[model samples]
Target: MEIRLITADDADRIMPVRAYAFDATPLTPQRAEELVRYMSFRLQNTTLAAEEDGEVLASVSGIPMRQNLRGVVHPMLGVAGVVSNPLARRRGHVRTLMHDLMRRGREQGRPLSVLYPFRSGFYARLGYLGLTAAKTVTLRPEALASLLTVDLPGEVRLRRIAEGWEDVLALQDRFLGSRHGFTEFPEYRRHQPRDDDEHWLVTAHRDGRVVGALPYRITEYGGELAGGVLLHDGAIARALLLRFLAGHADQVQTITLSVPPAERPEQWSTDFAGTIASTVAIPHPAPPMVRVLDLPALTGLPAGEARVTITVVDDALLGGDWTLDGAGGALTVTPGASASEVRLTSAALSGLVYGALGPEEIVARGLGAVPAEAWDGISTLFPRADPWVYLDF
Candidate 1:
């Protein structure tokens, strides 16, 4: 099988593969025409496919994105749209396509790649480490009633996304700037078509500035209210947004929102010890996985002064002995360093850098072997934090 980028003419071959893998509607001639027209405007140059005898077997798309890594923004590739034909199952077509995509991303100067996987173990084999999954919090609207009782400074307004697009982007920029593992939405996705009648953009304004925003959709005829892309400046903004959501109690039965791992919604209430009445928050089992493509490019990550040598084992992409030297709050990676004190896989290294896995946890999981003397340095250089991605690819 030959791995190559899919073109507009190959839509017919790929659509069936995608339809079968995703259980999407059967592809008809009209659907093929629609895909061709869509691809013409939103080109699929970044989408790779495996083909043999002029038939597409498997495909994956890599979307270029920028993600904040410990306060430093770096180029990242968002992997999505992975599919394979049923006839091609058990073959290595998907693996080949993924490897090609990773190589292309590295060539394009992307240091990291992230994807929400169908199976976490499948991507884990490809040197990707799972980060903490976002929590889906479901609660009765009355659970947030306490937030509405306060006379918050900010006022929440409901508007269409188009009317508040600029303010929304600005708030997201500010949010991404301060957070770790948050990725900015790609320009193409920002301009994608949306059903304005079904979706609403809720924003919180303080001093005539957009302090927070959340895009939501009400489903099941007031049975559920689902919100995502929730960004806020501070406690007041968050409270205001929660209050706005509480106002929907009469119309919506439950308010469901996707929150980052670090967010604790129950704390919003004055009584923090008790549960929010009947709130159920579930962390997604399969979180987005991350892989480091260019190790040297991450030298600029903020860290305390420490010097540690490590070896990455069984990694085709970043396998070798290296020294990580952090001095004056900046890290520098020196390749081919000897006297390694820690041994780990590329997935462990990615987790450590992303602040999802600490040295002790890595050792506990058997992902890495660290000497007693190296624990402090490793922990200092790669401090633990809950890495979260607000946007889903």
Candidate 2:
């Protein structure tokens, strides 16, 4: 079998494998056309295919993206549309594809790769970390009344989505600036909400400028209302949340929406001990798996008087030792280890890089031990922050 970059004509061969392996829907002409067009845009020079003799058996495609790590944006690879023919299972096609993808990403200056894993353990064994974590909050409409006071400087209003799409995009960009692990898509048009859904586009405005956007979905059974809201901005999260619940109060009984992991019921309302409730961690929400392809690229460390030399053990990915020195928000990386070295695997390193887990948490998990001499400086090197994946692809 030969593994190599693919051309546009390769889509014809790839679409069928994808349809059969994933969606399982027959690849009709129309569906193939739609997919091929999208693949042309997202893939272009970035697709890889595995073929034996004259038949294509597997494929993997990636796009360059910048994901926020702590507050610094680092170039990364976003993997998607990986598929293999049913008969080709256990042939190591996917493994070969991943290794090539990692090497390519490293060469192109992308330090990380992320994906919504079909089997977390498979990737975990391949050196990917399960670090992305988020929470969903369930509360009554009445519970949001207290937070209405945080309403934006202006007012909230409904607008035609096609007309307000630009405004919505702007607000979302503003919100992403402070969020970790948020993937900035190539364009907002790719994520444009379809009109077929029972959803609404609304936003908060101040002095005729858009401050935030709220896109909500409503689900119902037997003519009663169930609530759905997506809040992206914490500053205006509560304010827009209040507006959503208040407007649908009479129509909806309970509302369930996502919030930061640290945002508890008590933080949502004064009566968390009363009517408010949650469905958090009973079955933890799965986050996108992360693999560190290039450590120095991802660890563009912040300006600080702290520094550390570390050895990252990535058996299937980029694994080696390096020295990381930083001052304030600036960082410098050397090819080898320093005397006071810290040891970590790809999984542990990903958590530290994304700020999803603190050094103490890793030590507590028995992943590895941290020397007392390097604890404080290394702790400063990897500050904790909530990193959530907002985009699937």
Candidate 3:
């Protein structure tokens, strides 16, 4: 089978493979046409397919986006829509496509590739390590009663997403400035809600500037109100958003907010702990995974003061001995001298660099080997922090 970039003409053939892999419903002629249109729209991204003798077997798409890595923004390739024909199973077509995508991403100067996997283990073999998933805090709207009583300076307004799209994007860019692993959605995706009237953009404005915004959807009356991309500038903006959500107490029984793993909703209100019904720390069954595509481009990453040399094993893309020197709060990687101190796989290295796994945890999980003397340097260089991706795609 030959792997090549998928064009508009191949959309119909690949649609059936994707439908069989992801959707169980029968693909009637109308449904197939609709899916073809959708696939055609998504072709703006870099999509690839494996074909042999005029038949498409498997396909994948990579979206060029940006992600924050420890306060530094870097280009990232978002992988999605991986699917294979039933007859082509276990033929390694998907693996070939993924390798080509990673190569293209690295050539384009993107340092990272992230994806929400259908099966975590399947991508784990390709050097992708799991990052912390977003936390879903489920609680009754009454839990935010205290926020309503606060005399905040901002006024919260509910508007359609199109009316406040620019403000929302600006607010989100500010929010992502300090967040690690948070990725911004592509421009095409940002405008998706313009056509959907059901979506609501709740904004908190102070001094005629947008301080906070929460885009949410409430499908049915007395059901759950689901929040999306919750962004706040400060304490008052957060309080205002919570107060607005509390106003929905009479209409919705429960409010579910998707927050980063580091955020503590229980501390938002004194009665939050008592009123919270359930908290799914990792709401998605398969958390998002990441892989470091261009390691050299990650120079000057903020890190603790330390110097360590390590070897990356079993990584076809980036494998060898390298020295990581993090002194004066900046990391610099160079060729290792002589024998290395630690040895780990590329997945382990990705986890360490992303702050998802500490050096000790890496050792405990058998992902790496660390000598007693190298603990301080390794630990200091790769401190543990919960890396969260706010955007699903």
TM-scores for all candidates: the values are 0.91, 0.84, 0.93
The list of candidate 2 runs beyond 4 A from truth reads 27-33, 145-152, 188-191, 194-198, 220-229, 235-237, 272-285, 298-300, 315-317, 337-341, 364-366
Ranking of models by TM-score: 3, 1, 2
Q: What's the lDDT for all of these models?
A: 0.80, 0.66, 0.83
Candidate 3 accuracy as TM-score = 0.93
Write candidate 3's Cα lDDT for 190-266 as tens digits: 56666565578899999999998888899689998987767787778888998989889899988877766667788
Clash number by candidate, in order: 0, 7, 0
lDDT of 2: 0.66
Best by lDDT: 3
The segments of candidate 1 whose C-alpha lies over 4 angstroms from its true place after superposition are 28-32, 39-45, 193-197, 220-222, 271-285
What number of backbone clashes does candidate 1 have, counting pairs of residues 3 or more apart or in separate chains?
0
Model 1 vs. true fold: TM: 0.91
The 10 consecutive residues of candidate 1 with the worst lDDT sum are 274-283
Error of 1 at 290 (Å): 0.8
Question: Worst ten-residue run, lDDT, model 3?
Answer: 274-283
Our tally of clashes for model 3 stands at 0
At residue 334, give the lDDT of candidate 1.
86
